[model samples]
Target: MAALILILLLALILGGAGFAVHILWWIAVIVAVLWLLGFVFRSAGTGGTRGRWYRW
Candidate 1:
């Protein structure tokens, strides 16, 4: 009985995941495309402060 319940629970979770996979894949693709575009169009302003000590 316990094993049967566990199997049913696992099946439900897996079925839910499978049902949303189509939408999830599209969301992932859109995010990846946006990230690539941002990298391509990023600016190069403001140089980072290097490790330097100035004595007053």
Candidate 2:
């Protein structure tokens, strides 16, 4: 009985980890798209040339 409970707990933990990883992947994709859009539509800065959207 204890072994069965341990197996179930392990499965639950692994399943939760998998779900979290999937969500992180989606977030990464969204951030990448936003970054690309920012690069494409960046505003002009000093010298009348395009400047980085991010300070870094």
Candidate 3:
């Protein structure tokens, strides 16, 4: 009986870990998309100036 309980507990722990990993994967994808969008907007908005607007 004790061994059965331990086995069940271990399975639950592993299942929870897998769920957490799935959530993290989605979060990472979202962050990557946002970063790409930011890069595009930043470069275009700068208009080739990059470092400064009109050099004072």
Candidate 4:
């Protein structure tokens, strides 16, 4: 009975950690995508600065 309780506690802890990792992975992906998009726009804007004010 004590062994079963210990197993259940370990499983619960692992499950919670897995869920936390999943949430962090999604957040990392979103941040990476936003950073990539910002980098692309920065490169494009600097390539040609003339008459680009109205483009925005």
Which candidate comes out best when scored by lDDT?
2
Over the stretch 17-47, how does candidate 4's per-residue lDDT look in tens digits? Answer: 9999999999999988987766566533554
lDDT winner between candidates 2 and 3: 2
Lowest summed lDDT window (length 10), candidate 2 = 47-56
Whole-structure CA lDDT of model 1: 0.77
Shift in Å, residue 48, candidate 3:
4.6
Best model number under TM-score: 2
Model 1: per-residue lDDT, tens digit, 1-56? 99999999999999999979988999999999987876666555457633223223
Tens digit of per-residue lDDT, candidate 3, span 1-56: 99999999999999999999999999999999987776566542355574422334
**46, model 4: CA deviation in Å?**
9.0
**Global CA lDDT of candidate 2, please?**
0.96
Error of 3 at 51 (Å): 6.1
* Candidate 4 Cα outliers beyond 4 Å, as residue runs: 43-56
Model 1: how far is 39 from its true place, Å? 0.5
**Better-scoring candidate (TM-score), 1 or 3:** 3
lDDT at 18, model 2? 100
lDDT of each: 0.77, 0.96, 0.78, 0.78
Global lDDT for candidate 4? Answer: 0.78
**For candidate 2, lDDT tens digit of each residue in 17-46?**
999999999999999999899989999999
Better of 1 and 3 by lDDT: 3
Question: TM-score of predicted model 3?
Answer: 0.75
